[model samples]
Target: MGAWSRLKEAFTREANISSPEDLLAQARGMRNGKVPVTKDTALRNSAVWACLRLRADLMSSFPIDVYRYVNGIQIEVPKPPVLVSPGGTEVGMREWMYSTEFDLDRGGNCFGVITERSGVIGPDGRGLPGRIELVELGAVAIRGNGSTITKFIINGAEYDPWEVWHEKQYTVAGVPLGLSPVAYAAWVIEETLSAQQFARDWFAGGAVPLAELKNNAKVVNAKDARVARDQFRAAVDDSGLFVHGMDWEYKPIQAVASQSAFIEARQYGASEIARFFGCPGDLIDVAVSGSSITYASMTQRNLQFLIMNLGPAVGRREDAFSRRLVSGPRFVKFNTDALLRMDPEARARTIGARITNRTLAPSEARALDNLPPFTEDQLSEFDRLFGSRSVPAQPTTAVPGATP
Candidate 1:
């Protein structure tokens, strides 16, 4: 057939046409539509398909688990909660939860909360209870001010920070506590996370690879560096429980760092809470002096808050938890023998002190460092290796395990 006839046939062919004319016309149409089907596009499409096919392999290259989000950024898997006592056998909840916040300054060290909450059974199943409302607890507001009531979703779980506060305001007893939608969403995600044997499983499904290349090199590079910087900065920034900065807020990658840093800080902070609040030196002294330990109720309440943050809602331990109340400074005790063995001078100061305040002085902070303990030299070495100018100190009123 002639070129024109072939072209016509290709354009209106009932059967699928394989003519070169058809290819040319198709190209023209694509061009008119502002689509560039260049070699780069082909190569990018091929690469993306290949990566999607071998995502598990690529993820396995890293030391930790990596998750790719809607935005083309990868975040690490959040740290799983560490269970107490039976250790790996029991699933202990995390002591503190971290989240992002909007800082008006929009620069270094943004505002966020390290929250503590407790679970109690009312008419319904075990639910979070008391002045321990989710709203009053420290968390970033998604839609309103810090004080405003709103819903927040973290890792797919939905929670209403307001509902908890409302219950508190009304003093509604046995309100049959329920997880907010955000919390419920998070609960689903958590269940999925738990069921998956490997982190790569999350991205294993039907994510279509893009055929056209959109060169997001700048955004991708910026995100990677920003995330790295946030993680590094959190290690350095000594402001709150989880050190975060707003200089480059929610840069996608930073979310990963923020989640991770917050989890770690809260985990480490739990022991400190146990030492400071669980068993304050003053309380110990009072009990030893043959006086009624009046702080017992306070201790139970504090422990209730701490345990709520870390304990499972229903289980073998549930009844034990409900039967006994939380109180005292939930401070994890240090072994004096171990301290003395580690540092004679630090030990001497620890032992020589006529009274232990449970309140840590700047110098004596090292005393309680016994549980997962670090010595002065170790802390110094950490600072040197990590290039940190300051050491983390707990708030005096925090009572170790209390959510600060």
Candidate 2:
């Protein structure tokens, strides 16, 4: 098949399900007095969106490398073209990782079709994919008999397991599918969305009157009451003064305390969503009450974030990539050293310290900054400025007043 044909086969918009059912259910009325919560509806909530986006954003930033073991040693190799442009030449590695990571973060799984394969075949009787095109989560369905997925249905077309690329997280025993944190946190999301809608509607003419105008002297006739109501509404709507004679009373209304706290409730909901997604509340910009963490430097902060929040997910993705994208002892690794990179001043201090202690060579340190090793003339100038690195005479002559 041509590349265009393969691309066509690789991606389809057909979904295993439709989204309007949730929308209709919500529109007709509440389901059991609560808004229906689905992936689509849940994303409308800012907290959920932020939590998922934060993870995907960070996941895509880490560069991936290919490595293989040789004689008890691991060495990095040039990454395959598929890793550089999985979706297409038009889609770079960062975009591909971002798209898949977004799906994995939101749904606990990511699905793609292997559109092309290499000429070399591995022991598994299948070649590594040369191209993989992801489709919408809605476009795929899983068929399993409890223990493992038996079939993959993409765009209403069935395919063998080998043709599909699937990665799953948040898994449990005896279940082929990943358990979605979004699905499990539906109640919190729904409550948050509902609160947002309530506040929106209240501001948009859904609340009780601001004040009631009443006459104490006499009961007004319907004709006069209608005229008076219109006059009052028209005056207030224009923010004009409502002039009235004696015997008229305007009683202002005050909202109950509960109704005025949805803003705070939304903040709390953000913290909850962050927790559900295993994201540090601070990393995702959701503040946890009575919790404060301090770090000495950016490297330390990023290290903590990687270890606590992103380490497991990164490891899981690395495993998936190694299993599916390569063969034999070859493996995939994410370059998290980029995350620990410090500012120039601090980096210089660190490398200088390492070189002084002989833990690292000056040439190796220069390479870390993408610089070539010092030339002979530069080395001679360095020797003059800061004494030679050659060891001092082994104190063959003991210190004048020291014990032997």
Candidate 3:
């Protein structure tokens, strides 16, 4: 066909296409209307940093323990080789958890590779994994149907779903892919960045001072104007002084709004980011005013945070670790009590109450405090101090002396 004829035919074919595949193709070719926010841009906002860092630090620092079920009771067990030291590096369990949580919170997913080696068998004769290597989320890709991951592509190598450890949050469209909070809250982030940039430029340009050169005869040329502008800049550049030639007037430009306005805008953005992450604004140093709610102590606030905000994320991590790292009745859990650590006085009261109510033994309470169990002598001493007192005969004589 002739070139023009071929082009005409292409247009006709495109006009007639009406398949689902065609629609998908068109959608893929088009750009999304929303502002695009990458991980770097999202982290530029202080609020995003506070929200993500707070959660990552808390989640990672919380103590994690592996337990085995014996006779319907859970007993703490030694951490597996995989859990004690992951990624085949010096990264400990806490650091690994922090990185995983940070990746999930920022990018919506985290990936790791399980390494196996020969001649490294457990007592049961099963080969234990040599190491677990964390992979950057950007370097990993997923291929599967809507419901499950069929394969993972990591650093140019393909892996089976079972060979890769994956954790994700808030899947989209029945797929296990996670949706990043940065992508959803891009508009706010953009506004915050713009406001900050404006403030920075305002201060950087000598606070936007203006120069007015009065030519009485109105005969100044472009050269004169250029010269005047250069002279003004040179004087004010780091000197904070402006000198002009004859008939020139210098007037500082007043800002349309005060610096506090921009400050408030940035503060609002921080709160919004915290809200998006379901974190408390006050925890991130965002001021809260005119509020009736009050926490008598930090413990109460932390308890509220755990119960309302961080609890679900912790539970999700525990479930993921338990399923991926253990077999049968063995499980993994984060000891959330670590986050609720109390002052010595409060801890004493709590443990004392538990011991008094018989819900917790003295030895168990001591162990919880990282103290060694009591010996026989110490146990006898505790019994002497707290044991019940015997009733004396004076009580009988108090009954009106009738039974003397």
Candidate 4:
């Protein structure tokens, strides 16, 4: 085959679909309230919600990977874009971007296009940021012959012009592996899970224990804090085979913007946390110049405490991503400023005390030293807060029936 022929194989959409009988069975199940109810359906519902409000917002569009975080974990799978009608017109498959932003003063153009996942959620509890969807009347694949195909996906299945040629073998340069959405999702999920597991293990003292901490006290300067975060994040990257952070930041804005507390924290703190934890990237400052930088938002007070406490131990947690989606920095600034707002004398006294004492109080030191190792229980709130005993109730969602 020529290069053009090879290109055709890799650049087309394909899927496994239910037959007429299968469709009828599914519809009947729906009517009977017995539709299998797999995680896939829940995910699809979540994805749909994320893409709903993209009618005309610009800047960052939703990517398909937005639906990756389901069930208290970051899922890294990709799904076909859910093309939809912006004006509710019946244009079958046309061209469209995921979001557009307009101001009477600024003029409206499409700003966000959902291409790949990056960790935002939809209103219905699905990750929506970094998601890309086909416009309601969108044409996805255009051939050199001036022909185009309409594409859409649901429940990890894709639909397109390729459906007519489903039986044809898909090959590229003598490689004959065909394309299918389920296969893609499976591969992506497996890879994502592996990386996540690796991150969890690496941070739990499995990588390199800071021997100095065992002998001396845990010393933390501003620079030391930065380095400690980086070292922990490095363990996460050592896996070398998994992907992360694609939709970690994008989903909540368009999909589930209601997470006010989480939204603030992520904008202020999570990014910093990600950086502090070892992102090896530029330090994202909470305050740049004078006013607080909006992007450096923070999570709720209690949640921030938990994340700061556990992050060095747990490589990554699903809650971090969700909270990050809606985070902003105002609340954190208030809390921080309030504490330091003490009178100059009190401030001097505090500073003098710290300068004089080389160590923390016994209780404070014990609290720091007794921090637990990473355990599935620690990840799940059902575990104890202090001791290794069991706790009541599984981790439930803030909203009932939210994608867990």
Candidate 5:
């Protein structure tokens, strides 16, 4: 096909998701003619952005490691240049992971153009993505059936499956495209956004539903009432007080309730957003209600978060990185210990316990504290202070019918 034909085809192709419906159909109650929930629009909702931000920050904080198993022990493998700089730019893997993770958290998918491939090939003769050039989700058009991607059209340029790097979450069994959280949860997000916008407009336009100056005791003529109304409105418009006589009373109908309900809706929406992102409401300051539960310390809270909220997502990322970044038995993993690090006193206690249990060594524990190995003088001091611990050998048992 000609360039124009390819461009037209790229623009005309149907959406990548299954069920073959309009992207915003699930959000039928969306305002302004049921507008679609793009990433930009969804991000305008603070709660949505907060959830995505929380996930992205945590995921990016982890350092990725490539290792191989030897006799069931993980042996650290030197990271290739590609792993260090996946973008083929000065941008390191951490920034790349952050951006891609943010995209995945918001849209359930991330796409990038492969700028270079390594000589080390993976399965199916497709080389590892040596350098990926990240692309905006808006600029990439995925053409495929529900289960498998056929071709990628990025900015009207065609690319094979191996030429692009795609990481997806919220996946279904038969769908090629990941189900977007923003799309599926659009109803809640749009409702929250609409409420926020309404509040802004209400304040900006100075439109009150209950601004009538009612006479409590005395009856006022229509002319006087109109005069009073005009005066009150003019004063309010000028950012002044609506001064009136004691006989007149101004009552608001559900005005306070309306504001309170909006606040409540925001809190509820925040909780829902935290849920959708698999985060603890408290972690994102969503303020869970009426709970007596408490953690002993921040470490416990982080432990709970790692176990219940972030573990599975981290595992999925490890799987993706293992499959795409390397071939053979070598795999990728995130150093999860960073998330569960304890305070200094607690850390010393834990490390001491491990040393007592013989599961850890003094040199290794020193490494955990970023300390160099003990010098001869330091070792002599320790040996002097605490007597040298010499192991006692067990008595040998002579075999009855065999030579000892």
Candidate 6:
């Protein structure tokens, strides 16, 4: 078969697997073809670090809350069991979110074991899964194909699909497993690693200095070459001098292009990786010079991030949690306001605008500021101080004409 025909056949074969074991075997075979990029090595790339950190940290910082719908309005309930103590130990909601997001970003999948639950009570009651334990992606395996997940294998133990929670990123048709960004972008990451290694090795090897012996002489054997190399190293190391015949020459290999070329290559790699992960290049410290994109303020940038990057992911999580943890009318939500919090000045401006438009009440604004509503005495004082100024005086046109 021609190369193109073989490539088409491989894709067709992968897309035709209908058995659970066949899907698992295909995933394992693909994984075995290359050294899987571990979380540690992936983080060494600045782009990966920036992308994962920004996403995980921001998502984790948000408050995960449970609420119930009543009369078409949502009311937040007291801390739900899932949100109050997700991992059962020191790991709470924030840590749970962080770990899940980290896994999703690194491995395109997040797995957690749901342990313990309580009978469904009133809308205000706590949600199910009294305790949840995060499972490392490396330790989890998909055991079925198609929409129905039969089981999950964690640490060599088989778990019913319903017993575990799973979140996945990009998925291909006929594949039940999530597709990892690192695996898809392996070539770019490898190039970046190689470039960094080259630079390090270059510096470690005395910056590429070359030496020529007198009269074009050459070492006759490996032992002679070793002795000559040691002598050269000794002279250079001890006195920064090379004792040689008058005809000896020393030269250094200079890069054809400026060092900036290497820097540009690395920068390009970072941008490529950021694109692969659906992150803005600038968020990962990839310079955005000469770009048309601009943000009027930090608030605008955050809003853009929410709409363009995190909106879908947040929706998926909310749906998953609602289906698994809550009963009718009750739903799980992450308070994204926590992530979009503004500076004091910006916050004040927003609140002021809302109040002026009468869309928000003064008491509600005060509550948002963590302050109690004004007491009757305080209200009276406020009236005394500013109420008179707000009330306009009656017009005195006749009196003004008489005075003129």
TM-score of each: 0.17, 0.82, 0.77, 0.17, 0.81, 0.81
Clashes of each: 37, 0, 1, 69, 0, 0
lDDT of 6 at 377: 62
Quick one: ranking by TM-score, best first? 2, 5, 6, 3, 1, 4
User: Which 10 residues in a row give candidate 2 its minimum summed lDDT?
Assistant: 395-404
lDDT of 1: 0.29
CA lDDT of each prediction against the hidden true structure: 0.29, 0.73, 0.69, 0.30, 0.73, 0.68
| Model 2, span 296-370: residue lDDT tens | 998998898889888999999899888878777889999877678888889888877886887766556656656
| Runs of candidate 3 exceeding 4 Å displacement | 1-36, 117-130, 206-223, 233-246, 256-258, 373-404
lDDT of 4 by residue, 105-131 (tens): 011111123344335444445544443
Tens-place lDDT digits, model 6, residues 1-404: 43223323344432322222223334444432233345557777889888888899988887777788789867776666777778886888788889999888777778888786667643445435667789776677644434445667788787876578777776655445566777667667767776776677666765464344333455247776577678877998999988777544566656657357778889889989988777898776788768997787887888888989987888888887787677777788877886577889888888888867877666666667566566666666757998753322222221210100
Query: lDDT value for candidate 3?
Result: 0.69
Can you give the lDDT of residue 176 in candidate 6?
51
Worst 10 residues of 1 by lDDT: 99-108
Q: Which candidate is the best by TM-score?
A: 2
Q: Residue 102 in candidate 3 has what lDDT?
A: 88
The per-residue C-alpha lDDT of model 6 at residue 121 equals 45
- Look at candidate 3 and tell me the lDDT of residue 381: 69
Instruction: Give the lDDT of residue 75 in candidate 6.
Output: 78
The 10-residue segment of model 3 with minimum total lDDT is 395-404
User: What is the lDDT, from 0 to 100, of the residue 153 in candidate 5?
Assistant: 84
Q: After superposition on all CA atoms, what RMSD does each candidate show versus the true structure?
A: 29.3, 9.7, 11.0, 29.2, 8.3, 9.0
Better of 2 and 6 by lDDT: 2
Q: Residue 180, candidate 6: how far off, in angstroms?
A: 1.3
